[model samples]
Target: MRQQERLGLILDRLAKHGTVSVLDLTTELSASPASIRRDLKALEDQQLLKRTHGGAVAAEVIYELPMRYRTGRHQEEKNRIAQAAARLVTDSVHSVGLGGGTTTTELARALGSVGRSLKVVTNALNIAGDLSVRSAIDLVVTGGSVRPESYELVGPIADRALAGIHLDLVFLGVDGIDATGGISTHDEVEAQTDHCLMQTATRVVVLADSSKVGNRAFTRIAPIEEVAMLITDSAAGAPDLERLRAAGVEVITV
Candidate 1:
């Protein structure tokens, strides 16, 4: 594999398992230990992982989501899904809960355009800022420690804040979803926070594009049934859609 791809795989493994030993990367990538060490060193230099005694551990702090990167991938599809998701929010949606991810970020923007006179609750600092200035919307940012990568507040403080609030709807974004693993992500802390968000909200809606479907990620956040609605682009294939439908998930395509 190319060095970049190999490093991505190493990061994925570390994110999933918490650590990646030299021998582990060597075996997984079919590379020499020296090559894997070099790759690890490069990743360490980028601050994506920390070098341990025998392997590398993922960095505790995630980098903030860059607008350039977020805007490029699945831009059109995310727009479609965002439009469809916006239609679900009516005058009855008094309270809103937002999660972290590129999709949910877009959903926040969509909500800003259509949702007026609403109480918005979110752990995402960016989303809070996005809706904060709007006169028609009352924004409530969940209290917690900030995770720099996603600009999200997570941990006990956020969890406690979530426990106290009851939302009419919660919008979630995910890294991957599979029948076996349900919904999953790259970070364990975010997964735990997402689980709490699911529980605290009256109705949970997951906003993901077609790419996330049927893909098993490192950390399982919530089961399929926990989501009352799965909103995605029209490209979600037949088999995955069928699987989601069979599992009693309300699937909505934009």
Candidate 2:
């Protein structure tokens, strides 16, 4: 097939599956691994996708874009952050809360492989769905109206469901996270739900990439004090890292 046609097919797969491995592409396209890598590299150069350690995801921009537009960017870093965050969940832990967005969603994916049964409470429809099928995870979704862009179920139903439960840990994803300004996300209703999740969890560990480390988004989720720890990639700026450290929050950089 032509390179243009191959690139289009790869992106289509990414859009459909949320991820595409090089091995799968090699099989599907009946092409060499070298050829598949080249195609991924080409799409990455165009900023159409972000090449991961094994494959690619939809490329995301710097703005508060939709989930499809922002899931693939800095994926490698996000994976590392997810790994570090997942390490916090031990066998003693029972319930966990997950907020919406790519980073938290990645964390949910990581939890699926952990050899322990966990009760997961989440307002994000995608995250809940990801864990729902895993026998190791006893999933409790805060059922409510689903938001199209992020696939998070916010509003009264979700908040009310979480209100009755206390969680061991909470992993949150946000558009921007500033040391002084605190953690912030895009939508107001989602922000409100995030607050409820935070209040319900004993320890809140936020999963965010370096891009969101010092930036400020539309709505505030909580202040810096609300967070127990922050997990991010090495690409995070030293200035913001130092500021967060000074705030007495344990900042883990992978």
Candidate 3:
């Protein structure tokens, strides 16, 4: 496997099992012991995990993996979802809000590709950085403390920045979306900041992969009724989609 794919697999194993022995990784990944150790060393260098004598353990915060390591997972699905979400930005939408996540990052790229003039508001440092070079986009990045895990700016400062702003539409990237629990993320502070963004927008469209469809994270952003629509991949389970639709959320499977 390629290095990125191997890194993703190692991180995935650590996230699920909390620790991984080099021998086990070599066996599972079909890589040599030396290669596995090198991968472990690289992850440790990034502070993604702590290396032991013969294995690696989860980092200080592992519930939410760093954004850099998450880019490879469900990439194709995210791109397709992003394209479908971009289609929702009609001529009427001049100002848009984008929440931070791997999928929303793809949406940012999709929006830029369309070459439509828009005023974009966001707290994601990476997304802001990507859109800043686009002349067609008037980027407004909120001031707040950055969370390294998700590259999101959150807390009182972010909430304050979003207070008076109004958005025509907001596409939120969530870690989890459930029929009863609604939309949620791993961090409570991030959830609060995201909720603030949602409150400012007339329409809220959640962008999530199939894996997030039926999951519930640590904190809830809002109830299902609060969101206007959900744009997810077709791989999402029918039962969950039906439940979300029953809760009055417009479900669009790309």
Please name the candidate that would achieve the greatest lDDT relative to the true structure: 3
Per-residue lDDT of 1-254 in model 1, one digit per residue for the tens? 67766766676677668788998778878999999999989878878789998898878986423332344466689988888888888878888789987788888888887747888889999898899877788888888988876788999988888886788999998878776579997778988998988887889988889988988767899888787889988888879988888888889988
Q: After superposition, how far is residue 39 of candidate 2 from its true place, in Å?
A: 16
lDDT of 3: 0.92
TM-score per prediction, in order, is: 0.74, 0.75, 0.89
Every candidate's lDDT: 0.82, 0.85, 0.92
- lDDT by residue for model 3 over 88-206, one digit each (tens)? 99998899999999999999998987888999999999999999999999999998999998899999999999999999999999989999999999999999999999999999999
Highest TM-score against the true fold, candidate: 3
Instruction: List the RMSD of every prediction in angstroms.
Output: 7.7, 8.2, 2.5
Which residue segments of model 3 deviate by more than 4 Å? 1-5, 16-32, 44-62
Clashes of 3: 0
- Give the residue spans of candidate 2 off by over 4 A: 1-63
- Listed per model in order, the count of residue pairs whose N, CA or C atoms clash below 3 Å is 2, 0, 0
Rate residue 70 of model 1 by lDDT: 45
Candidate 3, run of 10 with poorest lDDT: 61-70
